[model samples]
Target: MTGTEPASGAAHLRWRPAPLAGLRAVAPVLVLLVALLVALAVVDPGFFDPERLLAFLRRSAPLVILAAGQYLVIVSGGFDLSVGAVVTAGVVVAAELFNLAPGLPWLVVVAVLLLGGLLVGVVNGIVSTVFAVPSFIATLGMMLVLQGAVFFWTQGAPRGYLPEDYRMLGRSAVPGAEWLPWAVVVLAVVGVAAVLFMRSDTGRTLVATGDNDVAAGLAGVRVARLRILAFALSGVAAAVAAILVGGFTGVSAQAGSGYEFQAITAVVLGGVALGGGRGSVVAAMAGAFSLQALFTLLTLLGVSGALESAVQGVIVITAVAVGGISWSRRATRTHQPVRESV
Candidate 1:
């Protein structure tokens, strides 16, 4: 049929413009998931068991949630390379708190979550904004600082362990029970909160600022505040996720290692723009799940754990390339101004 199409009954048959870009963006992830499942099934049929799979997800929950948090900062025109360090710091802080004399109460744990996250967020936001440092450099420095501090505190190892109470957040405390992992629960809670936050005025402001800070500021969007909040929110979310991860994996010098890249890759795979100002929180979370699936598939395939880093590197490159191509296409469309001849 012609583009304008026919009368009532036949109009329904007229082809709608396909969601081609959306489909394309989603396609790789879907293919990857399918490939993973096939590989897993072929490797070991027992890998398909629901219980084992759920447990697997529990393990992935923290990284996925961290991805959701990083999406906010990146979409709002900033990077948070410090997230891996922030998470490591968070776990260390939690462990230290629990190690204190007289054994701290549960309230101290809650306070630690809130306070630790806010502190890190504040530092990231302030350093980036006030010093006018590029987020990449700022966060990179922050990561080093954190790593050094953690090392100094622990003397090259994590000094303490999460108490049984805090460990419950990680899913290991459940023991023989098959209930939802605490990591998943924490992810769900933070993930839902992030979705809601993105829907609020602050969220919109963050996106607007990311898209064009000059325009957003002229429109009364408090650009600096929004950016700071973005980093802070990310910091807090990382803290919460750290609890789960630390509990699940147990404390080590490597706790929360290399997670920043994982989270960023997940966000990009979910279709968030790299330079910011586009995408959804839900999609970001979906990206997290997709990453987890990829890792799981790799594990099932008997791929060496050593290869996981290589796989992550490949995913990051592919996602960034896709984002760049999309940006070029959009820029081409938008910047082609009208011209006239005399």
Candidate 2:
């Protein structure tokens, strides 16, 4: 057939892409999430009910928010292992604030917590970039430092209660619409903002920097600033998560424990590359939901809580291995040279 002529009847019909063609990065996790949801429905039919589902979402909001923040850092080619500790520290600090100033407004306390988290993120970025310390080591050290400080200050027992207005965000619903929890509202807002940010020029540049800093730098991407911006946003996310946690579950020294790993695993499961550059923010949040579902299913099946960490470790390792192989093969094909016909 000539270039301009129809080769066959097939040429007359326009090819329609698969429903999930545009969602290649998130397809696996989406499928997994659907499967998990189905299983949960089967095991506990009430889970699909509006009230129960809203309650579940209320509980899942913190982790989903964390995953979104973690997505920023991971996509920027770094880790923020200190976020969990940031959450803990945020809550403890807020409680201490109230102890020192019993009449302080909740809004002011939230602002302080957010500022503290931002400061922590700045420190993490500076240590990782300015001092040339690896993010892993830097964040891990930060985690230890924060944990130690919290323990020292609180003596393993946090004092003061979160004001009623603050707790309402976590435990209450909209005034007229009891069906909608404030936590869900916050999650929706955060999710929308994350999606919008990912579509912006800065977000695209951040991904490019994560994918290849040297190339991005050559293109005048301001790599260091972007990385720091990413860490700063992550810190802010952890703070927001802390507020939600403190509101819902009350203050505790261990409120934010294990969250860092959970966030990492959720991002990995969402098909985000560990080495950097790739994955959707929405998918990362979905990963958090999937992880939460998996845990819920496990609990229904009477699994031991002790195995939760083990399960997370296995998920992280397996996801990284699989993603690595897939990325390697794609890279190989992309770099393959074309040969001229003799």
Candidate 3:
């Protein structure tokens, strides 16, 4: 047993990579984003001008915010098909509320939207986790419910107007900082918070639960609660995105149409695993930017807008397939025994 035997302890202990290793996971998405930006600059150099670039970021903010929320749900091993519907509902509801209460402060409207989003998320969580329903089914049902409600409420078109201040969040610059759009500022805030959250104990536990719920539960992690939190956060993100979209593009029944797929595509593009447990929030947001850049570049090149959805579909399928292969290979390497001479 002593001659060239592998270490017994090495065989017993699971090998884990260094914490810093995870940081590199975002590199690919960042590279892709940079390339897209470069292409955009080549197509329309004016696109890089400070004012135009800021404006571009302003437009990209809603999708970026949605991607952040989707990242939470997807990373927790669940899907939130309701976020797009939530955005539509939020915008329509807010407009209606303002119509009824013309003097309602924008802050009040914000609070209501956030609370509603939270409520929707909790329902999504309870239905999926408590009732043992699959998250995909639960969220899909929620999407239908929201969409129906929006249609009934709006009667095919939004009936109310969003006040200037309310719309400012999506379109205007900070009151005193003319150089910064509110959307950019909000994006910065959300980005910082998400990065910090992912680095925290709770965030790590959430990731662990996504990686392996049984193992995380055994380790004393509250798997259900975390998954619910993921859904709730996703809902809040949808609400915020709704506000931005409403302001940026104005009210319409289809304000958030197709956004769910776009957000998912952005998340996948950022290298986030569809099944969850491995990805960076920064990368997810970068993926959103890259997506927006690609669209802009296409437009500059006279590509038909109808092709956006097709591009997203292709990107999603490719990213997921490549990720599956990469993960399979890594698993194989990780499980292989280390041989050594004693």
Best model number under TM-score: 3
Scored by lDDT, the top model is 2
Tell me each candidate's TM-score. 0.82, 0.87, 0.89
Give stretches of model 2 more than 4 Å off. Answer: 1-22, 311-342
lDDT of 1 by residue, 1-342 (tens): 011112346445523324453355454455555666676778778876877777767877887778878998888888889888878887787777777743777557867777888788878888877777777778889899999998898888676677777677776534565465656666667777786676566886787788778898898888777888888888887887777777777677788888998898788777676667766666677678778877777776677999976886786577556555655644442222221000
- Candidate 3's residue-wise lDDT over 106-181, tens digit each? 9999999999999999999889888878888899999999999889877788898999999999999997889899
Model 1 stretches with alpha carbons more than 4 Å out: 1-48, 172-178, 319-342
Better of 1 and 2 by TM-score: 2
What's the lDDT of the predicted structure labeled candidate 1?
Answer: 0.73
Model 2 TM-score, 2 decimals: 0.87
Clash-forming residue pairs, model 2 = none
Model 3's TM-score against the true structure: 0.89
Ordered from best to worst lDDT, the candidate numbers read 2, 3, 1
Using lDDT as the yardstick, the better of models 2 and 3 is 2
lDDT score, candidate 3: 0.82
